[model samples]
Target chain A: MESEKAKILPFYVLIDVSASMSGDKLDQANRIMPQVVDALAEAPILADKVRFCVIDFGSDAQVRLPLCDVLDQHSSLPSLTIRGATSYAAAFRLLRSEIEVNVKQLKADGYLVHRPAVFFISDGEPTDPEHEWRTAFQDLTAGFPTYPNFVPCGVDSANPRTLATLIHPASGPKQMQMYLMEKGQNPADAIAAIAEILISSMLASGQSMAQGSSGMILPAKQDLPAGISAHSSDDFV
Target chain B: MAAPEEGPVRPVPEGKWQGYVEPFVVGDPGRAAAGVVPLPDESAWDRKDTVLDAFALREGRARIVEVRAASVRGLAHRAYGKVRQDEYGFRRTANGRYLVVCVADGVSSGELSHKAAMIAAKGGARWLAGLLDRTEPADLPWGQFIRGVAVMIERNGRKLLRGRDDLDAEKCDVREVAQRLATTVLYAVIDLHAVDGTHAVHVVTVGDTSAWVLREGGRWEPQEAVKNDGAEVFSPTVHALPLPPATEPVPVRTTVRAGEALVLMTDGIGDPLGQGTGPVGRFLADVWERPPASGLEFAGQIGFARKSFDDDRTVVAVWPVNGR
Candidate 1:
């Protein structure tokens, strides 16, 4: 029998907009928005193959862009407006719904899909309520045979333990990276880097999908940025 | 399965379609993956048949998993008659999942270079899929799979050359035929079985297309040695080479763990950014360090680099999260 031919990858960018990200954090993401869109346009593969979405969470979670291709509607990407507490649980629940709808749509259209990716960017702990974030995360992952790729990026202000839990079960040696965005550093530069990494990861995921491959591996600690540091899961809470 | 057909697999258009013309701007601000070109409905080209329509249909799934893909006649002008080739697919198997992603730049030098690229893409996808299905995930004979894929391509090329009636000596020569269809294939297979709790990543690759991983602390590092930055000699672009003889095979593998992200991409990422580990590496590092932005934001960054760097780029990321 002819094996399946297409793989669908859904990328959700979940940004934290708590009060802590008020200044440079928010500004950097805004400045680098156009550049990120431009990168996808130039790459025909990403331009053609990937569907993208954005969700911003602070007091609550909001969908910036539902599953859409950046190559087609670059200008439509939602603008970021920061204000409120970090409700990570609400954000995860929202992401779960978005992923389900998009995955179904993709399958109905005859595309083979891999698991969706949730890129969680945060600068603080969950101030909304305890265990809510954990419960939502668990419920979302419960249905899948393998866990979806949920990546957590921690800004300097973020609580390491909270970030550790975001990357859960895989904590300790497998904890997420802590991005040390020093004071005065251009937020644009960080945004640009984030964009590049997302695009690169999306592209890489597409490449791996085509090859019938599973998850790609992470780089060694030495290979990453100098300021970024990895702490054991115990270091968090 | 059915026997090989004697005629052309699919019909080629007799003449160019009169599609709306848009400037092939490398770094234009408003370009998106698959949006309407904001014109009067009547003025717009048949939206259904356009490349953007196909993209819209598949974008969601394409973003999440490994899947076969193709893009043609959009970015460049028709005068050059360029047809972009892209194929991506992923399958989770018994031993592991196989991922294949590649962009074939048909030798612009040949009469039917574009055709060759399309064929390579279709044939390659079919061949890889078949091989993955046949091989149990537990017995992922990497070398054997690579050889089988190459053989399938050669075999398909011969069939196409023999069947095409429009081609004469210049285009029909088998050796020249394969040469004209030159493409760079970058494939990676991840063995989840190899994931023994600790971080272990196995990646196999050929040509300049790259494989990388992002660890804790948001550090982006290369998984393969496509270039030697140690000597300060950076050859960032993936080097596409002639496919080795059917008897020989090339494949590399690595193992990865939890809390890590894996990435793979085509060489179209371009120079300066593509040349060394620094630009792409740093770019990814920053992305990992920061919070997750929207896909539009991600595309904006990639589009900026493409315009500034001037190359067709593609990147993919895979991160393993804790189940509970």
Candidate 2:
């Protein structure tokens, strides 16, 4: 028991930086990212086990920060700017490849990696054909070793039903969540809320993982700020 | 009837358990000057077995009960994760008129949160106990009270890290180094002798860990409810020691006569209880209503089929034996 050290709980934030998320949405993402990172950094036990990754998806994908342990992360997360089109396939595919490499790396480093959580934030539907993005989702979420707990957060003009499919979790430790950003609120505040929820959700899940429970146990949808919350999932308890 | 209590029992602690332990923040002499002592040994942390130690204090009416155990998940994961980041302490004033109960939850992300929790709980209990023994301030001085504790922890934390230079409070580098050992605190100062015969319980909270009182008629009132996220407690604006510019503590006052119980707990149990619906809800209700007979019995129920959540759960409870 004295020898048992808590495993690392990795979190990935995937942003869709298509043209639609250009103005306030993208700006808000840049402004609020440091707060999110700071919140995670402020936690004692969580900072120790939780590693963070920020990935951007548009016409192509960008690995802003490869998997870096929050404990060792001294700087803020890389901010995302506007890009071509919302290419879900490019993001998921890149994530799939990254997971294989990163998970292995963390394990090689002697830290038991708990199932990771991927927060997929997007606005509009995929610019790519549905068939391609859907196929990418399958490959990224279903595999031999495992898939991450995917939480798809759809903001302004994004289709909730389609986003639901992206939230399929590969393991019990993973939980399914879909947040719909509400309209009418200040866009900046809304974007900040999104970052807050993601950080909060990740911290909660990471804590559950550290304690040795199956995986992340997120807050109920009702717990979220109004206008954004967990869309009903068969996985919801 | 509950299953017969079974476990290899450790001896009940005598005198100050904290005095024997060194603060993990042993690196800086200044931080060491502040009193952030670490545990004496690893065995002090509960492993597979439940730790239910009731030490009859010489100073006050409330019998101090410490309830801790390896979370079910902690036990299942080959004991990989250290037990939850919950820590509690009790100290009776030298005047023997007050018993201070303190619980601190280490910020999960903070690498040394467990140490923070330990320091907050013990440091607070001892500080308040000393305060009560000397003078009782008219106003609780919530901010100043916690500042003293954090000052000690940071002073000690810096020492533990072996600071290369003399400390500069205004410097971000020094603050960040000390802030590494962050934690949230919820505490209470219970008057051994009541105000005109009504027991007064003063509760204060910084982060999520909470305090509640249970009445004879099965009345349950919480001093603090679970926040939606860390915003209320975790924000830079809010008060947490080791971190600079600590926020004012949330304060609550309630009276408890005989035949009543007071409970202090961290979020591991609060999340389920705050939701208050399913099996976990029922279990919480039962605990308050029937009150398990022993620490092991109480601990068994805490770890019982909590379903999905696995964060450490700690509950420190006190039931007055007789009317003052």
Candidate 3:
């Protein structure tokens, strides 16, 4: 008999590819994806535990990079291109279905799947009606077995209250975190910070597993980039 | 000198039992092949532990049981140049009526947790041994015993902090100091007295350190369910030592017949064992049907390489010696 399947942590990076993110912001986004992937590639032990995925959302949402073993793939992530509009509803709906399908497939493959973590980076609020996006967000979160740890990172022109609302587990100990750029801080720098957050969180979370703990460990508040401020949903409450 | 005359070679029997098969590595060896570069501790006065510590043999037929134990640095720790955070110890009462064994894994976040593991395994085992000598097993107050050990850890931890020149020990918050030296423990006591030729073993555990009974003919039976089996989301949150208020050790009681062995280990070995049906468990079950010829061999068996299961591995096995 062989050993039981090793545990895995699935991480989804959702980049808003709307018109608002056109120009320098989109370039920064494209540049960071490869850097983040390369960072994980360098640390094979941490890479072994992480399953990386890239999702792009505009007027519609699509799986730009399917959930995969970043270490095994050894392929470059697709560059994000500007698309229709910022549709939070599309992102959440697609995320819900993707998580449901991905977690099921991972389980079938004999890997012990951990709760998925979705890092949502946006420069603007949802283009759809408040109720429509909220319904989609609720579907992505509430009463779902494989619901994700939603980390919403809001940059230039992005509404803090809206990003706060996007946080899953709105009022619990395991509540999701929100990050925003400080006033006048360059959005490109914020993108770099997001890259840092993504890589650090992946390493920290993987290290936790290596240490025999299975929790998703975020980087400390002090470790956040200078231009970025972290908050829980409570600030909005 | 004249050579002796050569004799005719006899054909070996088909399907006959062969000699010992050494434990082999599986999957990626990772950075373990690069070898170790010792990591320096922040406090220079505090020296790091040896990377590997395995007794060739620590067997004693005290009353009815024979004990064998070993502790080894994990490949991940070795690759990272970190000291082995796992420790194990065994003690026998003066009257030789009982034997106590302890295994502890220092929580990784705590820099000084390696010392905590040492205290828990060695200090805790010694304390438990004395307690057994004074009190009857049935009358033992387990909750009080655990709390007493917690107090012992705090006292020893304070002494460790005070020894450091960098920090003011008295100014440090007591709770934070305790947290910095957290470790999980599993303690087992074998009742030397035999009831119908079977010895009773009492096990108390906090966190994920576990115990199993390996029966004759290669059957591995986990004493209790510690890992969450078949759960979609596995939380690594463990309840470690210097435990919260009202925390009680998870207790398990079982009998070990002669030829059967009771084994205690940390999650480094338990996570890989998973319900004792995997390759790791199968290998262990096959190799440990009888006590290893030496503790070096026992440590080798405990440190078998399996993919993605690298963590500090420590084990203490108590086998009941027949007719002892």
Model 1: how far is A231 from its true place, Å?
6.3
DockQ, all candidates in order:
0.01, 0.04, 0.35
- What value does the lDDT take at residue A140 in candidate 2? 81
Clashing pairs in 3: A2-B279, A214-B236, B56-B295
DockQ ranking, high to low: 3, 2, 1
Give one digit per residue, the lDDT tens place, for model 1 in B1-324: 111122334555887454342332232323233332322223223321112101111122322221212232322212112333333334344333444333444433333444444444455545555566676434556566555555555555555567566555334545555554544555555443334453344454545556766667656556656442322111122322235534343454455455566666554442223323444455656653322333333334443322112233444445443322
Model 2, B1-324: lDDT tens per residue? 231233444566886343242321111122112222222225234433334544333324443322222222222222233445567788877777777888777665555566777788888789888777666633667778778887777766665556436444444474575455677777788776655646678888877777767666655567776454322111112245566444566568887755567777776666555534334444455565544655555666665432223456677776654432
lDDT of 3 by residue, A1-237 (tens): 333656778999999999989988898888766776687656656665677788999999999888886555465578788898989999989989989998887777556788999899999988988899899998888889889988999999999998998877666766668889989999988988888987888877776666556667778899998999998888986
Q: What is the interface root-mean-square deviation of candidate 2?
A: 15.0
How high is the DockQ of candidate 2? 0.04
DockQ head-to-head 2 vs 3, winner: 3
**Per-residue lDDT of B24-50 in model 3, one digit per residue for the tens?**
554454333233343443453344343
Best by lDDT: 3
